[model samples]
Target: MAHLPHGRKLNFAAGPSALPLDVLQKAQSEMLNFNGTGISVMEMSHRSADFTEILTQAINNLQDLLDIPSNYKVLFVQGGGTGQFAAVAMNLMRLKPNHSADYFVTGTWSQKAAKEAEKYGKVNYVLPHTKQFKGVPHVNHWNLDNDASYIYYCANETVHGVEFQEPPSHNPDIPIVADMSSNILSKELDISKYGVIYFGAQKNVGPAGVTVVIIREDLLGRAMPSTPAVLDYKILAANNSLYNTPPCYGIYMCGLVFEWLKTHGGIETTAEKSNLKSSALYDIIDNSNEFYHCAVDKEHRSRMNVTFRIGGSNGNENLEKKFLEEAQNLHMIQLKGHRSVGGIRASLYNAVPVEHALKLADFMKDFQRRFGEPEA
Candidate 1:
């Protein structure tokens, strides 16, 4: 807590998560005058040379971090990941007339994407879920349509704390679309594997009001007749993501965050640190015996969102409430699980340091010793 600047709590919210303190401090310093422009970033015109340079550098920095190929165009758009759900189907579905694109539904977000896509064109359910949305099922069990326009899946399901280590294999002709809203930049990835990767800026990037979309060149220019001009990727790409007013402030803050990542050795080192942080937290839950259980299968567990619940004989709502209260008292906030899936969730985002995660793990171990295995 003492190390945290501005007395900020250890935030673990799902989206709109934490941003690096250095980035915030820089933003604060530039709040009144950004780069001698004598105007706040929020007040600047998106067409101004200063803002354009910022946008250009941001894209280049991101491309460097993710090793994005020259063919991929990075656009900062509005409407977040949810907007892309419709945009993707409307644009990519034009590749084949009326072909049903496959969707691998793993959690709440994925299911929503599938439903939205149905409005644009036919949709294929690839690995359907029954009871709970936990770990991802095997690809062998998936019923994929090779002739479909493209295959869609959420790279990280924030609600259920499920994640796919990489994009799924599909017909070579069909592109793979991924919603990486929650886990983007938390680690290294094969950007080339996905034809389109979209994520809301609020999570690991910067703030809300902006969605970053990376689309391969080959996948552009195929939008359906009904696709809106604002939602069309090719149009946005042609304009270098400055098609309209745009989320100017969000893009500015995101540029700062991207610069911050590049200074820290990019995603390669970040992934190493993330692995350690997630491992420390997972170890506590695994060693708790009957005291706790993570619903997600081990292999597909998310390095960003760790979901679990108390499971001992003493486990109940009252104890869980007590746990949340105690966590807050200790300056750890937003540790409660999502309302949809009641339990506990600790979102280990890129900005969350490893020491904080270790502190939470220590607290969990202490809690188990006090209330769970008191007899021992």
Candidate 2:
């Protein structure tokens, strides 16, 4: 196997996370002429038999990895996760027009989802953040509208580094929709618990431009009057996501990723690996002894992304800058925090090898010994 160029750093970006090395090489080999067709996948017509086989393989691979039930339909569409926020509201708000929908606001993304839904129908924000957006509030404290149409939440709040360790139990009759953008396919999930699950492909799945939607079959064709034909689940599902020429290349890449995951022992093994990487990083943070602090609550911390800040009397700006500079010098790129929060973040996605996390942890310990005050 060809190796990466010397001195190339490990990437820790939250979105557009690192892809498997083999997948990239496979794409490179197929870029000029796929299967002797003398054409790139990007140039193939959506209706061509080659592209049709590619789409079918993509869907089949996804279904196999997730073990999706026959009752669910997977649609690969053009919009990103943000577009699904509006699409979900449009298709699923078909209950009696005046009824409200419940939203569990764990962080910024859920809040945005609620705001979009409000334009389509009544929206009730539930489980508000009271303790600095640290974790999901206790379910009993939620003020759910008994007559609401559905309940929505973002399973992994990538920006705040919060994740729901357990699924929420809301009105049983109402469907539960989720945005699993950053954490999808990293672990196993009970698909039956959700009426709809949507994710952007830029994170763990594949590349940008494709959004995967897995919806229960019963929920199709109930779109609101104002819903566009393209956004309607019924139309997309019926046409097998080929309505208006889907993002073919993105879907093909996703298939390659799914195959890679299967060869690596599927979601269970992936979750085990992810747990080890996260534990290694978090152990460093927790043991730093006032030198580093993680903002998210321990129970709700995300395994996919770890956010932390250095300790000091003043803000830790100087230490953060030093860490970034040192990390760059050490060939570690994109370890900076998200703009919404001004602290360091390490996103340990499935594609990031365990050795990468170990190296990062070692760097953190060395940096602390050099810069942090000695314990008295």
Candidate 3:
């Protein structure tokens, strides 16, 4: 609830989102003399002992935070989540080289993941494709492929604001790969249920350069012959995420964030705060008498990203524009929705405080009162 540094604005961008102010200050303090190495983390050699300590400490903190099982290996790689889309297919498809992977597309990211996988091997849709992604279908209705190499899904869809509250029920023999790009560390998870979980750090973790991949040991070493060494999970794991330079600075920043999360009572406390934050915004939208609308189903609404409109279901462009302008005037930025969805999106990443969400909620209520049609 402490005020942000002077001139700092509340940020709600979908990715490349907010980093905790504490993390930023710590980074700034170490910028010139990281551990007295006399070089910035950006300048340190990945092979140097100082940098090795940073990397190892980072991995340990992340493992502790997630309680990552001993059977899984965490790799920090490049290319964001989009890169992993291909890596997931190339690595896992070869698990059952003759079979396909089942994709349950609930939103834009999952849809893109499925499409990218097709370049490597057959991708079967578990649910019939729909024009709009508003909510997840019942598991019973899903057309799952029991023989699939893996079952893929996105934990949270940034664009549609739909999220899977829990991993889908699937055959134990088939692995489950999840793109948790936008929602990792927001809550406690049963890590054992997943085969591979990958996330681009820019969302809730840290900066844009590093992508974290946590894959079960058995799933590694399965990349197709044509797979690039960089994108190959087995190669990255074997090298300890240093097969190449890796994202040293970004990974360092992620380490700080992880420590911040741990010091702030870890994932359990973070999840409680996240639920309160999203609920504050959703309550405003729900009580707005149709002045505001959220297309996603109530149960599937994302705790990380809340997407809605200023007007009715279709939205009122002028009023929405005015809302953004006013919010900017008040130092709240990046509330615009994705261009494809065309509305408003308020990303409540872990670094974002619940106080900010309440501030936005107050703004929404005031905006509605001033511009909304009077109820008779």
State which candidate, 1 or 3, has the greater lDDT.
3
Q: Estimate every model's Cα lDDT from 0 to 1.
A: 0.88, 0.87, 0.92
**TM-score of decoy 3:** 0.98
Report residue 34 deviation for candidate 1 (angstroms): 0.7
lDDT of 3 by residue, 293-369 (tens): 99999999999999998789999999999999999888899999999989999999999998899999999999999
User: How should the candidates be ordered by TM-score, best one leading?
Assistant: 3, 1, 2
Off by over 4 Å in 2: 1-7, 129-131, 312-315
lDDT of 2 by residue, 267-295 (tens): 99999999999999899888888688887
Ranked by lDDT, top first: 3, 1, 2
Per-residue CA lDDT of model 1 for 199-248, tens digit only, reads 99998999999999999999889998778999999999999988889999
Error of 3 at 126 (Å): 0.7
- Candidate 3 C-alpha error for residue 208, in Å: 0.2
Error of 1 at 365 (Å): 0.8
Deviation in angstroms for 266 in model 3?
A: 0.4
Candidate 3 residue spans exceeding 4 A from truth: 1-4
